[model samples]
Target: MRWSRHPRCVSLARAELRTALAGWGLLVLEEAAVLVLSELLTNAGQHARVSPGREIETRFRPVGDGVRIEVHDASTVLPEERRPEYDECGGRGLILVDALTDCWGYGERSGPGKMVWAELRAGSG
Candidate 1:
């Protein structure tokens, strides 16, 4: 699914993911998957320095017995995981994603940007 670079797309993507997981009988992974998607999409929206109106894209699928969540944006900037200071109120999105997902990473996409993705198995958090 393609989403615009707006805050509302976060909730919209979550709703779609919820339905997709339900249909795939992967409810056990829903909570963590939702959080993962949120962080990824938010990071893309906040940090993807692309031309205006360039839309971010999302893909939800079952990989083996797990679910794969991919967020594609038109920016080549990759996300980094950093330890936030005690006094900092931001910059912990990727940290949360790493803790929640079984494995997550970013790579080149077919087009002009990169895709950030996370994979979650049924029993993982």
Candidate 2:
């Protein structure tokens, strides 16, 4: 799925993820998947240096008893995990993704962008 750089895109992606997982009978992982998707999409919308009309892409695939979620943005910059103070109101997206998913990381895409991905095992909640 592709989304424009808009704030509502996060919730739109989450809703799509829920529908897809439900269709695949993978609702067991829907909550975590949605949360992770939100973070990735939010990052893309906030940070990706794509052109004005460009959009970000997101993919969901099932991989060996787990679901892999990837968000592709038109920026080559990768995300870094930061240790935010207790009073901080942001910067914890990657941290939550790392703790909730089986594994998560970012990679260079074939084109001019980066893909951030995470995997959630079924029933791993």
TM-score of each: 0.96, 0.94
Q: Write the per-residue lDDT of candidate 1 for residues 27-62, one digit (tens) a residue.
A: 988889999999999999999989977899999999
- Residue range 1-125, candidate 2, lDDT tens digits: 98999898889889889988888888989878899899889989988977987789999988877789999988988899999999999999999999999999989887888999999999565
| TM-score, model 2 to reference | 0.94
Top-scoring candidate (lDDT): 1
Backbone collisions counted per model? 0, 0
Q: Which ten residues in a row have the lowest lDDT in candidate 2?
A: 46-55
Instruction: List candidate 1 stretches off by more than 4 Å.
Output: none
Whole-model alpha-carbon lDDT for candidate 2: 0.89
Write down the RMSD of all candidates, one decimal each: 0.9, 1.1
